[model samples]
Target: MKVVSSRDFNQDVSHAKRAARIEPIFITDRGRPTHVLMSIENFRHLTGQTETIVDLLAMPEPRDIDLDGSRPTTWDRQAKFG
Candidate 1:
């Protein structure tokens, strides 16, 4: 990773960002690391480690739905009594 002083960061931000693509760029303040600049793709790939709701829905259902309607369902039986 490349390290840039806070003062240099403002003057050479474009170069610093280009360098960050290969790895991370550390922004230093008084010789101490303060922040990091990374590529969006890398950031998303690292943060998108969990399964989203859309991904879960795209998968198959857990079990059969029993959509036959041939069996006497609750509504069918209730109508006879009521």
Candidate 2:
């Protein structure tokens, strides 16, 4: 992981771009982390969106997912409901 202050990042954008390939580059503001820069491959891996259901599920159903119940409704005493 590489960290870069916003100033240096702006000064040397190329180095930051190259650093993003190996790992993520953390951009900080006032010593606090502001943003992260990562390679597209790493981003995909981190988000887990690239994996197919079959690949993620592996064996069988991971969990029993169902939505058989109807949507619930909430009403306030001052509000009308039909």
TM-score of each: 0.55, 0.58
Lowest summed lDDT over 10 consecutive residues: which window, candidate 1? 69-78
Q: Give me the candidate number with maximum lDDT.
A: 1
- Angstrom error at residue 22, model 2: 0.1
Count: clashes, candidate 2:
0
C-alpha-based local distance difference test score of model 1? 0.85
- Candidate 2 versus truth, CA RMSD in Å, comes to 14.4
| lDDT for each residue of candidate 1 in 22-73, tens digit (9 for 90 to 100) | 8989999999999999986678688985667887799998686777776565
List the global CA lDDT of all models: 0.85, 0.84
Clashing pairs in 2: none
